[model samples]
Target: MSAMGILSYGLTLCFVLVTFYFLRRTFEEKKPLVFDGYYHPEFKPVADVFRQNLLNGKERGGSFAVFHKGQCVFNMWGGYADNEAVRPWDKSTLTMAFSASKGVAAVIVAKMVDLGYLDYKRPVADYWPEFGQKDKGNITVEMLLSHQAGLPLLDEYLHLRDIVDNPDKVERVLAAQGTVWPAGTDFGYHGVTYGLYVDTLVRKADPKGRDIARFFREEIAGPFELDTFINTPKSEYYRAARLYTQPMWEMLLETLMSTRYFPILGHYILFPDSLLVNVAKAVVEFTKDMSVFNNPDLREVPLTSATVTSTAEGLGKLYGILANGGTAENKVLLNAELVKKLATPLSQGTDSVIKQENSMFGPGTVIMKNPKGQLMFGHSGHGGQVGMADATNKVGFMYITNYISINGLGDDPRYLDLENALYKSLDNHESNIGNQNI
Candidate 1:
């Protein structure tokens, strides 16, 4: 045989062997998935659904936790944190909470308001003078938190470095930017800008001059003994979930073919802030391709609107505090007055920008109104994570997942199923209590 032909045959043999090795690894018998936290008997159906999803390749991995009357009643985690499924998600696993961190940030502010340190009705300019520039002087803290400031999109293009690392430069831009609408007339979801606004406001308003990151560590995370963080520390890198995006082509295909997938992207194009929405979409598209979310530098930097890392248990406990009237173990984190203020709605109906039906807001939290007019408050992240409190019932529940869906607002069925199951459990508990009382 010629020398060239011999080399070609050898290369082919090597390729086959490498392919076989990986195929074997992929099909290897998996260990039985287990959860570390205490599981409630009533939640068995929920757990079974999750287990089936994992087995059927419908889900990757995630965690769920719920608290009732200031105590954790259910905690469970399963599936792989990594896309490869080589590592199982355990008690120590932390995943990005994305927009849900807004709720946590709001809790911190509520604490300040409870202590009479910050006022919601006061103009943000009262605290940060530079923020008053460009006719933003009238924008109150409530307006900004409720996404009514009309500054949702950045006027200028911001590189990833600017968004992730440099807060000072971003502050300068915000100081000079004018609102798209009158300060409180309309509402929009401030996708990336909310964090900068909140952080800047919090830093200046804080008596200690502590930024959100510092304040969260010293006050909220430490005192509450929560595992959540606005900016994840480097030492905890090993525990953080490595994120994976569903293929862009797959998503685009669904948008084109599926009736259910159509409105999500369509709404962004049809909205009043379509230009801003397009620009924001472009920025997210740019980041997704580069694996920017997994960057160590990016993860460590505080982005109160996004980039929070926590276990379901941590978020659940935090919400549990809010559910139980903002007091945990007799330690008052948020007083009764502040709790009332936090529940106050800032908007009357569907948000103009977010297009969410009948959504309301109170500072940083999402106020969900039921048909009967009762309000349930909390926040949901970009993927499938949700942390919420039903204060009337004194219930807190959280669901976190690695499998990210395109529309996180209300489109993901997986999260909706879990939520329904949780509410059903709550109803059962309430009935039992009533029976016992009778």
Candidate 2:
């Protein structure tokens, strides 16, 4: 063989070895998955599914909690919080729940409604007159909360800093921009813009000019004594789990393989000018690196659409109040009538940006079905975190993880397994109670 040929063969061999090593490292489990927490014996099935996820390497660090009838029935935490497995996930460990923050924001909105600070049917212009520009005069507060105002992605580019620093400028840009679709005719996932718009609305509607973060902190979190935070504080930073995102290559491969996502991916690729493409671009430009969320500085920024940090227990308890007649330990967090209004669907159809069919939006939350097909309302964060309230059964469910998945919204299989087990356990428990009665 020629010298050049030998050199080429050597290089190829080295490349193969490197790729194999990384692949093995990615898949290999370095340690046993150990969990510590409490669960009712009747809900042992739910606990088993959670353990399976950790043992299978599907979850690196996670916390799952289920609140039934305004009390915690199951709470579990396990694995490592950091990428290197240096920090153990514990009862206090908080993970950023991404868009799950939206659900908490929804709760705050409901409280505002309960307090008579805002009305759903009234025009947003009535509260924030500046938002009336660009043919948005008729958009109601409910329309804005339900994402029916058609302002998913703004026309101009915006940085995270821009959003955090310049409130007036951001509000002006949002208000002056025309809807991509006819206002109230269509709906899209607002993503980043949801927080910006909602924050402004909250400030305008609030007599003391409080933003969503402050409003939530002072009103909801404080009153409920929950650890969830739209703006995580420095003292609590130590307990925050570092987020580890799936590699872009892995995400792309999964997207290509998915039956639901492949067509949407193809459409976005084929038409760069499509709403989906624009929304993706806006999000990518804003977030830049998913790992940046691990930074305390970034996590401290108040973004209600995302960047909520909490343990599963904290979120579970908060939603538990909603699930059980909108009260926390006998204290009224939200009126029963207001809670009923929040559970009612306000908009239903195909989501223009995410391309989800039959997507239903309630006041400020997504209306979805639990595994048992019972009506539930909540928001799924980016990656895999979820927090939801099932009013029919008086159940509040939350699963938080630092190991980010490539799945869309709340479609992560690990989460689904736990949710399925939870409902099944509920069914079994109910059946046992019936037998006892007989």
Candidate 1: residue pairs that collide: none
Q: Whose TM-score is greatest here?
A: 2
Where is model 1 more than 4 Å wrong at Cα? 1-36, 163-165, 253-261, 267-273, 276-290, 369-374, 436-438
Q: Give the TM-score (vs. native) of candidate 2.
A: 0.91
lDDT of each: 0.76, 0.83
lDDT per residue for candidate 2 within 168-253, as digits (tens), equals 77777878878888878888888777877877888889988887888988998888899888867778898888888886655665
Per-candidate count of clashing residue pairs (backbone under 3 Å)? 0, 1
Report clash pairs, candidate 2. Answer: 99-381
